[model samples]
Target chain A: MEDNQIKNNSNESQKASANYDVVIIGGGPAGSTAAIYAARSGLKTLVVDKGLTSGALGITSKIVNYPGIVEEISGAQLVEKMREQAKLFGAEYISDKVIGVDLQSETKSIFGNGGVYNSRFVIISTGSMGRGVRIQGEDRLLGHGVSYCATCDAAFYRNKDVVVAGNTDEAIEEALFLTKYANQVYFLSQTERLAAPQELVETLKNHPKVILYAGTKLKEIIGENRVEAVLAVQSDQHEVLLSVSGAFVYLQGGRPVTDFIQGQLEVSQSGCLIVDSSFQTSIPGVYAIGDVLCTHVKQVVVSAAEGAIAAMAIEKEINGRSRMMVDWSEKKQ
Target chain B: MNSVIHVNDDQFEEVVLKAELPVLVDFWAPWCGPCRMVAPLLDKIASEYSGKIIVAKVNTDENSQWAVNYRVQGIPTMLFISKGQVVKTQVGALSESGLKNLVNDFLAGKN
Candidate 1:
């Protein structure tokens, strides 16, 4: 009996050491939103992120489209605002990549560069990653004129000639935004027609500072240390030199980072989490929200809403667990 | 939060067996504390690896027949199934990396 008691005590200590109320992975919009809600519910919440400055929406230069923000705001500024809001609610922020998570034990643990974190609930908000521009000098020239986010670095090229590469709505909108700061903005589309919205297309067409080039593929970005020019292939197979101080590659779709959670969770071929209406996955205490889930449209507002809903469900689960403990205690007495 | 698809006996075969990717079925109950601990990890993984895998849950309390057939002796038993066969069985909670290695191996056609 004494041996059994010792074993039980060790197990209890292990459980206590591994226990946390909630640990949210990814400090982007979805994760931060979840943190705000979770912390507001009086749960001990920790948000782990990779410290990437630009999220999906952070790539946009001016977001006049997002609801509630009457005036247009830069993507970086908006994300910072969101981060501040989450912090205001007492959400602890941990800047690190979560290498792995342990869910099989009674106390869930998140393994990362910093250390292991144990939590009963976790929200994964690691947004999609920008697809790499596979070519020589691309990596080396990164931040030297070759950039992915137009919103974050567009201001740096004020009064200078710049090139925008992409055919998506966000890309077109970014090009339009660049016209304000850039002397001349070239909107290069690889497709025959611009894949952006009709309204955005009309806006770009009428904008005098913007130059639209269709079926133009970026061949190579040339510069000694900074981007000075780009070799572009025109639709007629004509090669043209585009002189620009900076080049913004605005690829639309992004790939999710799900390699870390592969076998334990059910994911779509596209790496989006499959969830029902309650945002619950195949596992009970687990829930997914935002761009990571299987959704037709990926937007900031949608992700925020999903975060709220997931937090509410987690709250219910926590309350249910507490009630069960109370009932057990009463029965024992 | 999106609603979870309740994979009962009627939809089990189609959702779990016919899935193109490997299916991870978590057998759990509401009152189980360990089951609660593992739920978020499963959800994080399901969303993180969506499309590459299919995640389903069988509530032992609600789906007693399925639980009986699987001979589940405890809550939070995870069965990793591929090609309609149980490839791996984990009885307790697992770390994210531990789960990732298992799934990656299965996806890579490695035992």
Candidate 2:
């Protein structure tokens, strides 16, 4: 009798989730923007979000250069507003981690722990979380000290020394977050220059607790049970060992989050989905956009634009399919 | 219990350990942000699994005995108790769906 009640509760939601015309897979800026456009175009749209602060933008502390916005806003706030706008325009949003996808057939299917969704057109707006620094002891001591998300694990290292490897936007933003709890933070960059935004770069350059390192390669993470120090090589051919309790590695050359769709899509050498000009992948009804594609710039505005373009293209395809001409004159004869 | 019951130090054993069904005890505090966020989710799960599981919360401030006994060092720590013994413990706040998955798995004896 108790099992029947649980089944009934789930079945109610499953029945409400009808077939969608366009299903945008990620609930980031790219996917939300796509949902806003697609839903406004009179198409049934659904956006699936991987809960647990899982979006690339959610990790971003602040974003100032998106154009039209006067003041700086946090990434999570901006994404929330975008989702709200999409919802206002009649886009359904659900929080579920997608486990697998089957886009070969006419009706593309997405499988998740929550439920399975079928759509005629599918958009893959799932962003990339750049490559990981695979130095010695990095993988073995993952939860011990090394962490990928500063928001999730920064609280564990209160008033302790930590190292943030790499100089990308994510790296610098996470380094800033670490400065809150960490007594001292070392921002290590392998290249000759830092790739973070000028505003953040300037802030880190003058911060009292932040120490910046340029033209340095992280060689190893030293520790017994937890992170103890980091071994690095400078441009002057000098080796330096910095003592730190925690290390946050943000490596260069990031790939898309396409492991679930590994056997389904035709990805490039760098793991980016190979899509045509219309953001349509090798499969006709399947589309991909944002950092997951082989695009040059990875700005939020660029991803939003790609989403708009993909939505318009999908609308056109849906309309064309309805008006598709078939010759049944021979059968009648 | 179908609804969320406040279990204090005096009533912890009777309300949770002695319950016929499996119990999930939430060790939380008022000031903790993640603990406040997970309260509603636990309530929803309690109602969904009414007869199958008993969900209860114990405020660490008012009830420190159980928290200290379980060695719960963090806020929003959830203890999955079965047969009067804790089978699993999870720390931190999870999404609604994440909690649902965990509860469903535990109910199915997959834990």
Say which candidate scores most in TM-score.
2
Cα-based TM-score, every candidate: 0.45, 0.50
What tens-digit string does per-residue lDDT give for candidate 2 at A21-123?
9988887888988998898778999998663135667657789999887788877778888899999989998765465576777887675534567899999
TM-score for the A-chain in each candidate structure: 0.55, 0.59
Which 10 residues in a row give candidate 1 chain A its minimum summed lDDT? A321-330
lDDT of 2 by residue, B15-92 (tens): 899988998899876544355557777999989888889999998756889876875545567988987898877666
Candidate 2, residue B68: the lDDT equals 65
Candidate 1 DockQ score? 0.02
Local error of candidate 2 at residue A229 (angstroms): 4.6
lDDT of 1 by residue, A1-333 (tens): 432432353344333334568887777677777887888777788887655353565555677766889877876567668788878878777654455565555566676533456888877777776453464556556656776544334445668899898776657766875776789998888877765446767999789999888899877888886788988999899998999988877553466755446466777786667777858766666777777664636887778877877777787788875321211335657
In Å, residue A95's CA in model 1 sits off its true spot by 1.0
Fnat measured on candidate 1 = 0.02
Comparing only chain B with the true structure, the TM-scores of all models are 0.88, 0.96
| Stretch of 10 with least lDDT, candidate 2 chain A | A1-10
